[model samples]
Target chain A: QQPVQSPQAVILREGEDAVINCSSSKALYSVHWYRQKHGEAPVFLMILLKGGEQKGHDKISASFNEKKQQSSLYLTASQLSYSGTYFCPRRRNLEGSTLGRLYFGRGTQLTVWP
Target chain B: EPEVTQTPSHQVTQMGQEVILRCVPISNHLYFYWYRQILGQKVEFLVSFYNNEISEKSEIFDDQFSVERPDGSNFTLKIRSTKLEDSAMYFCASSRQGYTEAFFGQGTRLTVV
Candidate 1:
């Protein structure tokens, strides 16, 4: 099943902050975050495993709450380069299977202006 | 740094024609995948391949769709009969393992006219 992403679109000025949320109805074993620029492939940002882990890189961070079946991506002091679509893909815990094929959300279009 | 590479960045094919999108995954990666995204839409998984066989495939991967790892370094997705709705950006991705982070290629923009 596809995850639901909040704030279908967001516009922010340089150095501003934004938060994107993703919620899944199924129990997720892992959550992966990616950023895709126009006409480019989706770039891996971070991956959070189950057990309520929080991971960050540079000015971007994410938190996964397995019990709540939700994940939030936080971008701080955003840069112009951060203007792109953010996607949260989830892997469900299927019985007797570990193939880990990701189903992505609708994505949050983020525009960072100078 | 290793990366997945795709060929024919953009392709236009007539409806009902056959088209094959190619990819070369990073050396030593064990898993390969194909995904597609319509314009301004979310990416959707088509199929996953491992050990030269399909491990999983979504409903979108119907009878007309097939994947092949014909050679040691090349992976390909073939659409037997293209349809107008098949126009989309096709991406090839690979991961070191089944549950690891995946790296995607630039993608092939397939336009079925």
Candidate 2:
């Protein structure tokens, strides 16, 4: 099933902080985050796998809570480059699965301005 | 430093015509998939292929669509007959491992007229 992302859109000034959340009903082997700008393909950001796993890049970090089937992305002291749409992709635990395909959320649009 | 590559950044076709979107997945990857996203909708999985065969597909993957690994390096999605609704951005993704960290191509924007 497709995961649901909260806060369809957000606008912030540079140095501001924001959070985007994603929740899924099905179990997930991993949660992947991506950023997409207008008229462009999404770019990979980071992946959260193991339960309680926290992955970060610079000031962008995300947490995956396996028990709750949820994940949250935190943006600290946001920059203008952070302006884009954020999407979460998920898959069920690997185990014996083959050719795993990801289901993505509706996406959250975030804009940062100086 | 490897990444997926897609061809014909944009394609325009008429209704009932055939269209084929091409992709070159990352080298050494074992899984490949095709997905579509309307301008304002979420990305929807169409099919996943491995071992040169389809492993799974969603309901949206009707008989009209087919996928192929015709050579050692290319994967393609073909639609037998196009419809206006088929106009969307098609993405090709590959994962080094079957179930983790997928890399996505820039995507091919298909516009059906």
Most lDDT-accurate candidate: 1
Winner by DockQ: 2
For every model in order, the fraction of real contacts preserved is: 0.59, 0.69
Clashing residue pairs found in predicted model 1: none
- Tens digit per residue, CA lDDT, model 1, B18-73: 99999999999988999999998889999999888899999999999999999999
Report the Cα RMSD per candidate.
1.7, 1.4
Grade the docking of candidate 1.
medium
Each model's lDDT comes to 0.91, 0.90
Total clashes, candidate 2? 0
Residue B101, model 1: Cα distance from true site in angstroms: 1.3
